[model samples]
Target: MTSPFLSLPGAVGSPVAQHYGAPVAEQRALDAGDAAVDLSHRGIITVAGPDRLSWLNSMTSQQLLGLAPGVSTETLLLDPNGRIEHAIRVVDDGERAWLLVDEGSAEPLAAFLNRMRFALRVEVADVSADFAAVLAFAGGTALAALRALGPVVEWADPWAEVTRGGTQYANGEHAGAEWSAVQLVFPTERLGAVARAVAPAGLMALDALEIRAWRPSRVADVDERAIPHEFDWLRSAVHLTKGCYRGQETVAKVHNLGHPPRRLVMLHLDGSEGELPVAGALVFREGEASDPEARPVGRITRAALHHEWGGIAFALLKRSVPADVTLAVRAGAEAADPQAPVEGVIAAAQEMIVPTDAGATRTIPKLKRL
Candidate 1:
């Protein structure tokens, strides 16, 4: 599908195409004071009617009963088994709710909701095409500038908000670290205005910024069959005490009991010498064979080049692998840079930890579902 924002010059095969309906560049610029993207291509599903909030809360991870109008929660859609079906963000306005999910998962998610719907006073529809969304990122003064425009609600995620307007809107969630997910929406007629208002940049830069932001998303890269715990999303998406929903048992059990069999880790790969290991490339620890067919310790979930760190990639590594083991990613002999060898290159692997005080060690036994 062509990206909706492709007309801006220099956008190629970007994921933004799925949401925008055109092939425009949707990523942010690195050096700018702030950056933005046309998020219209993303899936937006609306659920409304009398049972909106109650019905949704029963189905997802976040507690939604008390979610005030104008506020939103980022959540997940889990399968009956608790494996992640999709990662979603929900914005509510008392009367209605908007769910932002991965582009590829949009249609399937809508279908899932439709199948789950029966007599409940809830209605669901895919609004992604009708409403175009853009993301803006700024710290310090930029947030204040955005706030000056309208009523914005900041959520528990610290640097996040939800705002709306005719040709402009602002919602900053997960904006801390280096980047924020900002949603700017307007009529297609005013896309240029929105783009100009938010300094449009090519999608390539946006991908890089996304890499820097450390925002975990479900994309073609990670795909389904990935448990949320593998990405450490339990901290951000799971509601430990929520009523039984799809996959709640697994989500709950995996958290309070034993550790997840696998964990998400960031790796600094030696990529300057060859094509960076592609997604799905097997990552091997020291002493693992170098043949292209060798069993991998893990698979690369996401990887990108860091100007400061050479090549950095997020991998879902087997928890059984010990820390400090040197890892290797595949580099085909034909394309591998002789300098950046397929063999002998050392990769650093470290579990992605949510930083907290290092002093306490607490483990709680599993609790039965509510």
Candidate 2:
């Protein structure tokens, strides 16, 4: 099972592409809508049968029973404790419902769905081996041409606008307001030919764009303790009024009565240390030079050096941490080693992504007196 993309010149791979030689140049090409990235590393799951929509709606956070064909939406599977377990990008093509997931999750997710179908007329299949996914940004012409070739299902990102039954926690203009990215799924056999036909961009380009948009990627952002509220995922992934589902009680209670214990923030690294902090880097409150015991308030989830914005990252921090607070992230260190702490601590300025007062449900009236 050789990847056709690996045959391309300058092809590099891990969980995603490191780069294709000129990382900056490739990023620019992608930003200008002149390139496409091979996202075949991602997995695909297909659910077909009459009960597909209703069954899915009953399981995840999003409202999917009425999901129109060609409409793109995302859903999350949470534990009963409300911790995020899985985040799925979904779309329907009239006949079949497609679930696009992170690499290594297809088999388990498909199996879970299959087991959930006791006597329901639903069939789930792991089709990752049969299909290839390409992510294209500003790739209107190439995408249209690809659609003409055969049946191509494109899931347009709905992050640009607040979706129905969702709540937006960010105030003012958000970077995702202008985000224009789409996932295109086609037969795996056509991958090599499609790569030859379209302009090729590396995964670095995709990472830069996603980070700039403050897009929360499941694989990158979700940890064992992550909840949807922490990332403001209700902005696009959860339906507030949706029927009962696992973790729905927690979701409702948090939105109406409580606040998320942590919040997601974008950090603009000071870049004075001449290095970027790696993911899982511990973040601390900026303390005095002599105060060697600065308290840790957060941990970096994703970090990247943008072509234009320099170094930036997504960090999940204690919700009490102010939106305007300056922080420091330990950089160039072995995150796995606790005793060998890195000396270089990079300064970072917080840009609020999720507001402090994010989840105040309107249904909950202001209490006058007890």
Top TM-score model: 2
Poorest stretch of ten by lDDT in candidate 1: 162-171
Cα deviation at 135, candidate 2, in Å, is 0.3
Best model number under lDDT: 2
Write model 1 residue lDDT over 245-303, tens digit each, in one string. Answer: 77888776765555566666677676557456666666777656355445677777656
lDDT against true structure, model 1:
0.58
For model 2, residues 43-78, the per-residue Cα lDDT tens digits are: 999999999999999999999987899999999999
**lDDT of candidate 2 vs native?**
0.83
